[model samples]
Target: MRGSPPCGTAVGCMLLLLLLDALLLFAGQAAGEGIITNHVVVRLHESAHDDAHQLAVEHGFQSVRKLPFGEGPLPLLPPMSPRREANAVPRKRQRLQKDSRVMSVLEQPGFSRQKRGYRDLNEMEVNISDPLFNKQWYLVNTGQADGTPGLDLNVAEAWGLGYTGRGVTIAIMDDGIDYLHPDLASNYNADASYDFSSNDPYPFPRYTDDWFNSHGTRCAGEVSAAANNNICGVGVAYNSKVAGIRMLDQPFMTDIIEASSISHMPQVIDIYSASWGPTDDGRTVDGPRELTLQAMADGVNKGRGGKGSIYVWASGDGGSYDDCNCDGYASSMWTISINSAINDGRTALYDESCSSTLASTFSNGRKRNPEAGVATTDLYGNCTLRHSGTSAAAPEAAGVFALALEANPDLTWRDMQHLSVLTSKRNQLHDEVHQWRRNGVGLEFNHLFGYGVLDAGGMVKMSHEWKTVPERFHCVAGSIQDNHKIQSGGRLVLTIDTDACQGKDNFVRYLEHVQAVVTVNASRRGDLNINMTSPMGTKSILLSRRPRDDDAKVGFDKWPFMTTHTWGEDPRGTWVMEVGFQGPEAQRGVLKEWTLMLHGTQSAPYIDQVVRDYQSKLAMSKKEELEEELDEAVERSLKSLLSKNN
Candidate 1:
């Protein structure tokens, strides 16, 4: 109304009001029209319309909103938005971890399997810690009370040179171990535990827990148990601290690898322990997932107690048919020193089954291997059980690292790896190993057994005495198991409690469309998986991750996976461990008995750590001696007083 009274102005105002009313009328037309019989498509200002009405073409906005923009969701089909549960995923086909439940795709068909009897035929009863002796004499002459052909004199040299694990920190990435197990209690740090498997903030298992495989427990015992108290046996390293990290559960390799790389619930606990790889032709160049490699690098860079971490890996249990070119995981790299089982010689004359000797055999292509052996450890509730494979060897090496770290304090994982390599001497050490073994069917560093055997004492002293790591021949064997190593390959014999193989009852039924929950301990790394050597009719299939679906990444708040199986090959019952891979593109491997190994590793240190704490031989109370002296003094005073008074 420019001038307030123009006739044109009044007419224009009326026209504008009319236009607004028309728009509103159009927007609500559907409400009264029963429905559009001819569906008209109109262009309108998005902001001006309620999924309807149209405005002038000059409006500065986008097109109209879709019909029913603000209407309540249609009554039936799942509400506009739906909620979901969480779960986990796999990373490979053959990497197995602690507690996991899923088989790998590699377990498909006709894949080559690695299996063989483990016999440390050349394993010897040797102790290479003598103060007096030509270090080299151990190779040709018998050792000090240890029946070996020669001594790993280098052990003494290292001791003389002054090297003990002082600044090193080893992370025991395996199953949940009994931090308080008498056999492995002392060496554990007061605060060291985390269940990467279940995402439980506290890694401790139940108070009265039984070991799944004992592989971890045995390994721990060998690594460090307070030495000298004499409750059980001595550890390779006399004084060293060890830690544990559980990250598996008979699940899938994908589950294991993801757990290892946890960043939320988020588990990110890192520890160096025995794990990784399968006896798959001994290919040291296994194509692991990216996260596993990153995790390893991170561990070394972020060591325990600030010194850095040392990870010890067991090469594999597939001896007889191993090919150096395909050595599986952890052992696949130079950073990881592969371990082979040796007859450290500390064994009962008979095994739990009352068998004269403990061993397992296998058929590798055209040969029959019978030289199987068992690693040593404190007796689990059940006497001595046969533990087979390189699975046992990795823990042995880890134990020595614990001892060395207890002394030196600055040795890094690299240092430990270097020491291992510098000591191996192909042929020269083969003879020494034979001497240590009393000469059984000992082969050089063939694909079957990696680089022969491990020497705890020899490794302990190497840091100071030797300038470079040994290559195939460790100097001294420190104190070792003395028992034979376990090698498998006969028929797949699955034993649980005391139940024999039940074709129709237990395992047979489980193999039919099974859904297992595998829990993996944080011990081994790289891609995880399992290769079930069973019938073909049945197969394992990955279902949607469930119950808890938070994140989709490898490691997160929600990544537990569930798999369903149909029919598989005809074999034994459930395997002691599952077979799988870390991911869709990973290699197959045997699940690591991280929990059993954790406890076993602690056994030796538990006994030895206590022993080293003492200085006197009797192990009696020093306080008791002082109390006796006081009594005698009192008696003398009374006699003197009586004489004076008389």
Candidate 2:
């Protein structure tokens, strides 16, 4: 009914009307949301540069900035009052759409970023009154003390989620604790504490001139120092209860003391943290005595109302020259051996490397800086930042375990180990001497770092929904009685092919731990190195060369060198063992006996699900790669077409 106004042809008039309609629609949508910004994006024809300035001025817009892409979208600001800006977009769009120099016009939409509903340790709101809390870099590392940022235990997120290790008790089995200290007084569990050294109920530390008896107190503070009391740094599990067993203050450590200390209050105590072990001199090979071994077996079998009491042992501070497997406590199946990592996520100089270490925590390391040491409560109601060594690492792990216990108290000792293997993070941890390797089922592990650093937040969250693992069983896979000789520079290799005791009551389907008991003697004990390869192709260095050991006469006697490297792997087929020497000169050795022991569950449905999930992830990864390649190919094709047309 209406005649064409400016354009002569009806098609041209229709195109103009359609463009104005599209621009009006865009402006309407922006105004409907009340998102009236001062700037607008525009696109101009290649030949319109000279007239762009004049055209922009006529539409109440001034050119401001050019986007990154060449001849791409340009930003223009409307020289108008904010009150008038709301109605300016539609008018400017109409005028710009009708101009010959302009190709298109669009109103800029308002956008704002927001924090995600889920939070990590770094993002959570934590209010603590302790003055030294910020200096505890291992708990909440924010690039303080010249350390790497975000390399911490991730405990804040767990605390925000209301898991503070409440209703759980961690016993410090060391010298003794200063329970009277303000920071530790409120959380001390006296009913479960005893001084085996004095054979009395008061487990207070025996004071001396040197204050050397502060080990137990410092370790206790790492686990359960009271929070918000304006004292020292807050503990990892600040709401948990701490008990001190004063046994290491004696003149000599006896089997009875060791047994009684390990078995004390097993029903009430959720975790027993032992920071002391054998001499760790790289020469001595010692372990729990007969009575202590019996007590440990009882603790795991009947402790915690049959859920099993958690025993956390420090992997020795024997340096690279010593292997922690020699300290039988760290390598035992009943204990969780924790190693140490520095503030920079590197292995500490004094950290002992072994296959038995389940996980790691922070320690003072070899750094000479005073702030680099672990900050905790000291003796005589004081505070210190000089606590160091694997002793500092074990208590941190015990605290993390306590957090998991508070989240789910039904977790067993073995369940805790499983959680450690599953939830621990490899976060920037590196070892120059040993490389990280994946196990048969793709679990990453290092001889020094074990599975990885303990992750408190991940462990606590997973523990909330964790189901108990299947009943554990043991199988004597194979036994080799024939004696073999090892030449100076050569190696002794033995192979045992078996079905892992199939069709028996003690059959093992999925492996948890493997022990290779060997009776061998060498001319130079320090040069002996032993390795075992599982049927699934995972090779575990059961025993590494300890350079400081000069004991040539008493070479290992029926020593059960254990390894957790074969965890979650199938135990079928043939297993291989290699024994050799590494030294300046060739050393002779003899292999008297070799016995393979397998411990695991007969059926683990969760492991099966894990394998399936891993496969699905692999498939999804491959699909994503293919899609990315196709996208790149299409982009290249489109660019080529545009170039040809130009």
Candidate 3:
């Protein structure tokens, strides 16, 4: 036996030993196998091909996904993640140079809003006098007497002919609107509007009835009241019961919640007007955002009216082949309609000497958008703004949709897409592959201009009488939730919002089935698994999951995929997955390590591994300033305390 160690020595030794053990444990756990997200390259076929399983989210399976048919084109780039904002354009970004996984995510084709030339809207023509906006069936041109669609003149004529668009429900889905605005009162279908943006915050909190720049108000004015009886311009569907959807982020941006919330609503809004889509490339593609979009499409397929429902999606503002789909709200294989632009390529000639072109009547500076002139409603609500782009185009089309629905509320979303294409006088039967490519190319019903400028009169005539789907397939997602709490054994229904305004860009989820995996290792890589069991049991699909690390995070490299499903059901079943050990792996002796993951995640984000990289840069600036401030305060306090002590 040895002499008893000194009390102090023993205590110190014990503490050192404990610290060593803790270090070892931390190292071991950190080196343990982990899970993460993975975005796989995918190319899905459109519904016209009937190969629905190719896409993770399809409209047929979503009862609320109001996507239209004939998805003309997709956007180029996805909108900025709701979690990120361009505080400052960095000179250099940490891009995924050669990493295919990361590069694929970074290089995913999407429209570029930063590029020039795409914003030549000030030079285009609204073609208000074009044949498309005409309505030979309704009446003659404002003065030409050949039957055209005009504002005040045609509206007055229509009223005289008993066409006030009364009894029609026009749903405008956008940022919250001021229900108390004088112009919106009589028409503000508050009972029809709902806010998915605010829970603790009230809708239109400040009564900031943002007049001149309010996107919702401007859009509403175009659709209904530009300034009823106020010598202002007339509305497309004047006298129409314009009910705002009251759901949207500011323009050119969106959040998952906003994207997902479009489907879960209380009232049955017949004609849903969406002047929004994904900020991704202009091509009309679908991904994780399919839930909200698909749900909206489901709403369409199911329809509010006995006849059916129709959802109108705005093509997008970056008109050229850029991200035309604003919020994933483009026409998919459902009862939805997409609106595009058709510019006569003309602009209002403004004399320079009187360049009264003020940004805001209050800004007193050179305006933000100097390029002026288009179909958009402008000053005093009488003239259209010089604004051009798919943003304005989509609303223009939505306005036309309201009119058609007013004429015949029985039109379904499918009728809107298919019929519009088949009957479009501009591109009646012309078909070309000139979608969202950067060629400024077009051919009849090109992707850039779905069915070539929504010809309202044509759609009205075509949809007079349509049929129910031969074997109409319907599906639904659910109420979009970030902190989703899906009950055990219960299904996670998704709300599909494929419109461009709704940013449902890529499908997202944690490892498909890796339940709170408390332990994992490299050897048992395949053991800890997850899967997306499409509601339809249609598993001809691929899955992607990231390989996690000891930190409970997965690196993009160790992505996972699933063997396509065998196939079954129409509206898809639950995506159930289980975790199990294969060949006795994942058993790293309980040294107290946890290889866990979120309970129910179906998405695999490759770019998430490197996101908001600029956040650190911004934080550094703030952190330094804070440190300096703290140092100064400490100095002052110390001086005061020392003097008192002395």
Residue 422 C-alpha lDDT in model 1: 34
Candidate 2 is scored at a TM of 0.81
Off by over 4 Å in 1: 1-168, 201-211, 255-271, 276-287, 301-308, 324-328, 344-375, 378-385, 425-462, 465-646
Q: Which candidate should be chosen as best, given lDDT against the real structure? A: 2
Q: Counting only residues 3 or more apart in sequence or on different chains, how many pairs clash (N, Cα, C under 3 Å) in candidate 2? A: 0
Model 2, range 1-646, lDDT digits (tens) per residue?
3764787776557545655555555545544664567667777887876666677677766554667775554646455445365666777778878988778787776666656422343454888769888888888887666677777788887898998989999999999999999999999999999999999989999889999899999999999988899999999999999998999997899999999999999999999999999998888899999999999999999999999989999999999889999998999999999999998888888999999998999998355777988999999899999988999999999999999999999999999999899988888788989999999899999989999999999898878767788999999899997778888768888999979888999999999989999998888888899999999999999888888888779888888899998899999999999999988887887889899999999998357554345436656765566556545655665566568769
Off by over 4 Å in 3: 1-162, 200-202, 205-213, 226-228, 249-256, 259-261, 264-267, 280-294, 305-308, 319-327, 335-339, 342-387, 427-444, 465-469, 473-646
lDDT of 3 by residue, 123-238 (tens): 32322342213221112223122111221112332333344456676766766555454445566676667665554223452234544335666566556653334433445665
Q: Predict model 1's lDDT versus the native.
A: 0.34
TM-score of each: 0.39, 0.81, 0.41
Assess each prediction's global lDDT (C-alpha) against the native: 0.34, 0.86, 0.36
Error of 3 at 398 (Å): 2.3
Q: Residue 333, candidate 3: how far off, in angstroms?
A: 2.8
